[model samples]
Target: MTNTENQARPIFPFTAIIGQEEMKLALILNVIDPKIGGVMIMGDRGTGKSTTIRAIADLLPEIEVVADDLFNSHVSDYDLMSDFVKNQINRGKELLTKWIKVPMVDLPLGATEDRLCGTIDIEKALSEGVKTFEPGLLAKANRGILYVDEVNLLDDHLVDILLDSSASGWNTVEREGISIRHPSRFVLVGSGNPEEGELRPQLLDRFGMHAEIRTVKEPSLRVRIVEQRSDFDKNPEACIDKFREQQIKLKENILLAQSKLPNVIIDYSLRVKISEICSILNVDGLRGDIVTNRAAKAFAAYQGREEVTLNDIKTIITLCLRHRLRKDPLDTIDSGSKVDRVVGEVIGDV
Candidate 1:
């Protein structure tokens, strides 16, 4: 797409999304620290799960990439490039750069492995007797967002591919006498209705946060949602214009949080609390401990604070570790409430 077309594409305003604050905050925090990993959103249909994700992507800042590069390789990703790309950079040639929107790539349910991870150029191989690597969705998604709608319905093998790529930050494609690797760093956002099916445990563990959303219950809020959506459907451009200022402020806030993230401090006591809470809840692996710490730090940065606070952890505990809980048949409490109770017992109320 041309830059002009990209800029002109209308998106629902992030600030105007009626509710689903948990999902919105999770997305914002992921943008701040992709290292915190990605989020899994389980909710009812038409609860704005996909809409909120797209809105968050729309508000993200543009990315800088090597102009004309097939893999959307940024300067930092130079080391992970294919030998062909590396050769171009090795010569005394200045690489041109271009600014593009942060990719929000959809991983459709039926996508083939070759299409998802790219494949060999069969025609080029036949005609030129040379092997060339074709890029895939993962390559395009580098330094951006990879969204999977109805993620629970995705095939197990494809789920494994996503997990592998997410864990290693690399997507390796090996075909007939050809292999290539590229940076595949991205915030993996998956949304699905729980009533459809349960996610695989391994894949669930990979996600940094989990949030469940529901339909709006308040009568007034529901009316407002209807009105705003109707207005946007009537004139998308006008709705975008109306929320332009708030969107800009939110974008600026994210940029500022990113800059501030490195300096945000996590005190030892908070670290102890994170571990203690995870231990109390019997969550497996250190992923819970690590993600909670990173999330709290990001929350501090988002709030323009230099140090982590108990409140930061309190606000984010459910998002960070709810999906990590093991089910107990005897315990009737929902996982979210269990997390709250455990957190309260371990750390007291913030």
Candidate 2:
């Protein structure tokens, strides 16, 4: 589908989502600070994981991009622009820009490596002496969200490629000595049912936060969710209209959070304590510490605060550190509970 058509598609309102607050918060914080890395959501099937993701993407504010740019090259930021865009700027060419909804590229479970990463046409290069490059899902996902459903089943090599590009904020394609590179920065979101399988520890640790969701057990809440879905299915437009005000406020809050994230700071003592928890838990690397700090700051910014609070860290600590803990086949305690126990020991009833 065309970009316009994709943006125009009706999506369930983010504010209207009834449960899965942890998953929603993780997503919002990532949008506020992409530096937090991204979120990995694990839950039961039909628990609204995909719906919640789509809602957040729909709720995001539009961004300006170079007109007709395949990579959605940032209008003014040099780091976010493609090499072609940079060359244009160097030549003093005026850039035409347009505002568009944030792209949300879904990665199919069976996608080939070449489809995930753009391919260079070697035959065209030899025939015409000009490299023909075709941008793939990674290019479309730049400056937006790249969501992978059933991620536990994705190939390990593909997961490695995604993590590498996510870390480097760029994708490079080379074929027959022809090479192309472009910005591929995006918030990588992956969701899956735990019953199928678990992602390898190393790959899971790459995600900034891990949100665990479950099917709603409360009958009343379940009924409400069902009713809401039925309402939307009956008349999507009217249902969206009902939550229009709330959606607007949420969108505004996200935009403000993004603007305020850079100024949000965590106290030195708190930083020390965060690392202490990671160290005590034997978390493999400094990623747990770094992501926790960033997630805490993003949480504070989302709350309209300029300084990180102990409460903010307490709220998101589990999401940041749970998946990073070394799993013991013998230990039955939950990873999230283990992280929380460490937080209590280190932060002391905060």
Candidate 3:
């Protein structure tokens, strides 16, 4: 497709989305601080999981990247640059740059290891003595968002590969004796229906946060959602125009949060209580505590605050700890509620 045709494709505006506030908050926090890892969204089918994810990509401001780079390598940030780009920079080459919309790559369930991780042409290497490496989805996903729909249905091994690359911020493909490594940093967002299946806890815990959404129950709200969707389908341009102001404001807010995140501070006592809840819940590892702190700070930054408050932690604590709790097949309590209960006992009522 031509660039114009691609750009012309209409998307539902993020601000126009009516419900699923938890999912939206999780996505925005991850965007503000990707080091919180990524978010895993579990919800009923048709809960706007995919729609909200796509809208987030559209809502984000354009990013500057190296022109003609396969990995969308940032022109200036060394950590976001690919190996090839870094080499060119090290050699003092003048790099051309351009601004483009943030990339959002969908990981297909049927993708093979090589297709996800790129490949090397060993034949060319042995005969012509040149390593010809083909870039894959991970390459394309660098410095953007990698979304996996129906993530629970994805093969466990493939999920492992994804989690590894996301955690390490790099992807390496090896063929024979040739190995090629490139930056694969991106926020990994996965959504799946709980009725279909659940991700293995080990893999799921690697996700920074988890947001559970249900289909809207209020009749009036449901009607509003339906009407908004219908309007978008009939006249996308008009629907987009309707939300233009809100969209711009939200985009600016997200950009401002990203810039202010480093300055947002969570108090020592708040950190202690965060871990205390995790410990009481018998959560595995330190991920729960660490993510909760990071998410709280991100939320504070999003709210244009420099100091993280108890309300900030309370707002995001459940999302940070819900999935990390050990599952008891016989326990009937909702994980989110259980988290709230523990938070209440440890931190006192918010």
Candidate 4:
């Protein structure tokens, strides 16, 4: 397809999406601060979970990369480049650059480990008497979004690989006496229906924030969703054009938030409050504390504020701590409610 045609293929605008406010907010906050880790969404089907995620691609700003770099290495990521690429640069060749969309790759449920983590180029090694490496989904996902639609259904081994790469920001493959390591940093967004199965706790905790999405229950809201979606389906281009201005503005806001994040400050009192809430919830580790701080700061930045506030903490606490709660077999309530109750008890409900 022509570039124009490709660009013209309509996607539901991020601003035009109906309900699921928590899911949308979680995504936006992650864009503002990817270090908050990634978001896991569990809810009923047809709640616009994947639709909301796909719409986010329209809002992403383009990134600068070294031209022809297979790994999408940024100018600042030179040290992380593979040896051959580094050697070429060391020979005084002027590095070429290009502007491309930040990658947003979908990891399929049936994907193999080799495809997910890259494999050795066996054919080339055997035919040419030279070793070569092939990049995979993890490579394509570098500095981008790696989305898993049915994350709960992923195999245990792939889950472990994702967890390792996520924690370390690198994917290493060692086979046939060749070891290759490359940057694999990306915001991981996963969605699944709880009715299918429960996500493993170890994998669950890997997500920085968790949001529960529900089908729109209000008739008025439901009607609005149907109408907007109908308009888009009838004439996608026109619908997209109508929201073009708002989409551009959102993109600009995200860029501004990113630039302002370094200046957004977190104070000692908020830190203590985060620790206290986590402690009250009996959270297992400091991940809860760290994600809470990062998410609140990102929210503050997104709202053009200079510092994190108690309200910021309250706004994001549920998402940060909900999934981290230790399972209580005797407790009948959900983790989200438990988190809210603890927050209300500890911080007095901003």
Candidate 5:
């Protein structure tokens, strides 16, 4: 199939969809701050996982990027490599520029190991190529999002490669008689059903937060959803007009949240409360605490608040750290209940 054929496939818009407010909020939170690592949406198939992500790709504001920079590296960045690009840029080079909304690049399950990292051009090298470098999925995903559907089913080696690249912000390739390394930094987004299989603990830990998305059950809401989806399928132009107003509102909310994140402060007592809560529940590592704190601030920012209160922390603690906590076979406290217990005690203490 041609690239034209592939691009013709329809994408669902984020704001046009109905219900699933929690999932929408979580995704928006990560978008406001990519430092949230990325989000993991775990649930049954056909739950609009891919749809929501693709919609977000379209909804995001266009980012300003460097001129012809591999990895779509941001123009705002200094300290770039590429002696050629760097020298030209330093010499006061103006850009051949275009604005692009963030790309949501997919990683298909069937992708080969070499295809992902890229391979050496043997024919080109032997001819006039002089070992010409080619781009890979990681290259396309930079300054954007790398989405893996059914991520739990991905090959072990591929999972390892992604985890390493995610941590270091670059992928190193030394294969096929060539040594190539490039920046591949991105927000790693993955969605899968937990029943099919579990992602490796190490890979799972890379995700900053996890959220559950279930099918909406309201009859009126469900009917509206189907009608809107049908309308979108028929005359996307009409559906777009109906949804764009909501989209603009959401986009404004996201921008407000981002701007508010820097000034939103968490009290010291609340910090101790969070640490104590995570400790009581035996959550592993410091990332949980850090993410919970940030999420609380983001939540407050979303609410147009200037500071994070204990209530804000309570609401976000589970959303942030629940996935990272260890489960007990003997004890019956589920992640949600565990969070509630901790929140209650912490609030009492504070």
Candidate 6:
């Protein structure tokens, strides 16, 4: 984000959000291990998709960015952040330190491609007779979260660009006489109403996991969620204080999960079993199998388990690989239900 947008921030706190435990867990899991890929939340409207992202604003670690660098590139990590920042001395813009938080930037549905990738500042270059590049949303999203609302409705061209940049971990532009390459290594979080539109398969595969969120059906749970949200909205400080302990515990859990993830063991037999599951489902890519195993291992670690087991694999199969599966054209399909049934027959019985 630019120096201007940094001045503006989200109003809600992540811990105070309510009624979407699965969605919340999925995001937290991604944060603990970004290798889990990224999260895609498709559900009904008003289910706190946007709110969940906004609330996470205060939950991330504060980072040090280049003073005026567009991508919020880390100052100390400049050796690896981007070529644009590396060539600052030749460009005559002195690199200064400007520490900023891990941002959660929202890309609106109506935003154009130029605005996202950035366009040449004709006024400055022509009138002043000098070259300058204007920063866009991607620049601000580096090393943070890039949130796209109603992502299914995004234009096809934009979707292609997003897929490429997200997969490559950088964005390169050669237009308007400005050839620039910069880092764009943010976790892509997208929420949309699947009924309204469908996400392109190419882009869908880019996301690591798919989380389906629905409003709470239980009256008591729904009421509690509303009451808590209302109470927090009315008195922010008091509500934050009450939930401070939960937040602290949650952060600690995340740190523990990160340390334990690499240590979680997945044996050859289990790897073969995971591959069998993917093969049975006719999933097309190796990425699905890889992500499923990683997520299962991560889940085991999160629950403080030392060894990977059948239950962990079963629990995370749907979250990890369902979105990447090939859809059955004739059958009225429930991907999650199918994943569960396969686990029950194959892994559960074992």
Residue-by-residue lDDT tens digits, candidate 2, 1-350: 78867665689999999989999999999999887889999998999999999999999989999996889999889879999999999999999999999999999999999999988766877889887888999999999999999998999999999988888899999865768899999999999987788888888889999999999999999999999999999999999999999999999998898889888889999899899999999998799999999999999999999998889989999999888874653332255988888788888875
Report the alpha-carbon TM-score of model 3 versus the true structure. 0.94
Give per-residue CA lDDT, model 1, range 132-151, as digits (tens): 88788999888889999998
The 10-residue segment with the lowest total lDDT in model 4: 326-335
Where is model 2 more than 4 Å wrong at Cα? Answer: 1-7, 122-129, 327-335
User: How much is 349 displaced in model 1, in angstroms?
Assistant: 2.2
Q: After superposition, how far is residue 275 of candidate 6 from its true place, in Å?
A: 1.2
Q: RMSD to the native, candidate 3?
A: 2.2
| Winner by lDDT between candidate 6 and candidate 4 | 4
lDDT of each: 0.86, 0.90, 0.90, 0.86, 0.76, 0.77
Q: Per-residue lDDT for 236 in model 5?
A: 77
lDDT of 5 by residue, 91-208 (tens): 9987665678787889999988777777777788888858756768877787788899998899979877876776677777786667777777777888898778767665676687
lDDT tens digits, residue span 1-350, model 6: 68967775435667777667768877887777766777889898988898887767567657778776667776557533667677775578767887676777888888888778877777998999877777678877777788988898888788777666666777877776789888877777888987776776666877888889876789998898889888877876788788788777877787788889888998889899899888887888798888888888888888987688888887778887777764543322245977877767767674
Give the TM-scores of the predictions, in the order they appear: 0.94, 0.95, 0.94, 0.94, 0.88, 0.88
RMSD score of candidate 2 (Å): 2.5
lDDT of 3 at 250: 94
lDDT of 3 by residue, 57-140 (tens): 989988899997888998888888888899999999999999988889999989998889988766888899888887889999
Per-residue lDDT tens digits for candidate 4, residues 55-97, read 8975898888788878888765664465556766788777788
Q: How are the candidates ranked when ordered by lDDT, highest leading?
A: 2, 3, 1, 4, 6, 5
**Which ten residues in a row are the worst by lDDT in model 3?**
326-335
Supply the TM-score for candidate 4.
0.94
